[model samples]
Target: MTRVDFMQGNIASAEGALAAGCRFFAGYPITPSSEVAEHMARRLPKVGGRFIQMEDEIASMAAVIGGAWTGVRSMTATSGPGFSLMMENIGYAAFTETPCVVVNIQRGGPSTGQPTLAAQGDMLQCRFGSHGDYSTIALAPSSVQEMFDLTVKSFNLADRFRAPAFLMADEIIGHLRERVEFPDTVECTPPRPIREGMLPFEPEEDLVPGFTPFGHGHRVHVTGLTHNEKGYPASTDPDLHERLVMRLIEKVERARHEIADYDIENPDAEVVFISYGVPTRSVRQALLDAPEGLYGHLNLRIVWPFPENLLKKFPNARVFLVPELNMGQMAREIVRHCDQPVISLPRLGGELHTPQYLLDRAEEYR
Candidate 1:
């Protein structure tokens, strides 16, 4: 348990994963995110962990799913195009209830438009990338420090919910050089219990089912198809399918307060600024240096779960500015959660949102 200095965001992610007890990694070499794999390759073995560079991102995702079944906390990192290749396997991990982490350092998309550049285009993809009705937890980091902390949180969430947790970052957050303190004694959230002699799909008080490792002598049979409490395939029962889907959704949906991030800089302002990821850094900086009297800034680090309850407290706001890298992926969620009109400032594909651009937008709201 040692802390390092002068680390890139990707390296910090690797260090965080290791600190969270992640012992297995499988990924391809993709830009902005490849450094995560590289760092894990060098360090995983020293800690009695395993690292593999698969032929492609598909195989990489599959490997981690298998690793998780073996009772090892695992992860995989890739960019936009590589992330697409991992969708099918990601769905597999979800249905099987595999506990692992997926890191997507997003870049210009469609089909590798800009490999080396940063883009927040994967916001929607992380939510809808996998098929079927499944709950995926995606965490976005605005700074290098968050890159470390959220990576650890992502692993904990994955283990807790028995679902694949995503660390969705853009190139800026992945490549940014910053000093991040890595805690030697990392405090991680606890996952659902897999007590011996209990059914895997049995819901605890929180509505989340417990997960157990394969070959643990509990007779668990995990499958990508619909399954029952025993983990054996059970697609024939409609009730079983409905129970599984509802439980998966409720597991994360019910814990929004535990999962969501909301910061209120000015609690008494009429106007609020809403944004996530790297753009939030600019928004905060802009508000800090504003010409004395300006609007309040509500920066969100957790995009999913929407924080519906917390949003009900802001009814007096005249306008809410939703600034993101895409054409309002988060704006859609903001509009759904708020009664006021959400002004969307969308920067599509490989572009960064600047403070001046946001300040100009904020002025219009006034």
Candidate 2:
């Protein structure tokens, strides 16, 4: 049995986190993303969870990291400016192998560019924003139901990969109100516990280390500095640092295709549109409004690690059209992955790419 109701996307995200066994939320309110924190505030304590409104995004992110260390699923929600503020701690989470979730309801940006609007400008930033090399899992939702489903998924992915996972929605999807179906009980994947003889940072065969929970009768040192399997700082050893970072990266990258979530339709069509997040709505609408089998679409839900192989699934694709809210941020990724001519359709000003607009653009490429 399940429950169905009209739900706002941000609220659905909060509920999703709760369903995923997320018991800690620390966030500062920001437009377009604040409702997630608000909903968590009203809902968390009732479930015996903790919710805190920190001074700012930086502190919120740090609090999330601290909460995760205490052996709980933790998260924070913010938009562009707040996302930027959390970069340092995000890097810390990556270095220390902390499992947490960060909800970035992206808005138009560069410095509070458009607080009330949406943009996919942070597409690349979420993957490479921090100082050093690292990898993360990021999910882009095109609907309210996905906001709920993917939040749960982010938690599970974070636990599995032992790093931060991102729910990268935007103002459009974050604010959209739609009917959502609630599962009877969502499954939660807890981190693997420390084995009897393994060190804190020592990885299993999968390149991911088992988690050392607090009060497990084991004391483990944690730091962001280059560390050994025992979690002691070893910043001076070049080879150890290289091995550590590479594992941090490969744990996610090596499993990228397995982690990828996308849908393909009309695979035989010559003109393929690759998209994610809200811009994908336009492509779907365009396909629906056109003749059957006239075009193909690859809609990606997991954008990070790029999932370059999905493009090859459409063997007959002669051209791939990419429509993004940013200036072709993701389109550039497609350019490198395939030989087909890729047409980038970029839109600004917080507007959806109308189906007519998409159809008109495809017409020009022919």
The best candidate in terms of TM-score: 2
Listed per model in order, the count of residue pairs whose N, CA or C atoms clash below 3 Å is 1, 0
What lDDT does each candidate get?
0.83, 0.93
Off by over 4 Å in 1: 1-4
- lDDT per residue for candidate 1 within 211-247, as digits (tens), equals 6777776667778788887777888999989988888
TM-score per model over all chains: 0.95, 0.99
Q: Kindly give the stretch of ten consecutive residues in candidate 1 with the minimal lDDT sum.
A: 306-315
When summed lDDT is taken over every stretch of 10 residues in candidate 2, the lowest stretch is: 357-366
What local lDDT score does residue 69 receive in model 2, on the 0 to 100 scale? 93
Q: Return the lDDT, model 2, position 63.
A: 97
**lDDT by residue (tens digit), candidate 2, 89-119:** 9999999999999999999988989999999
What's the residue-level lDDT of 123 in candidate 1? 79
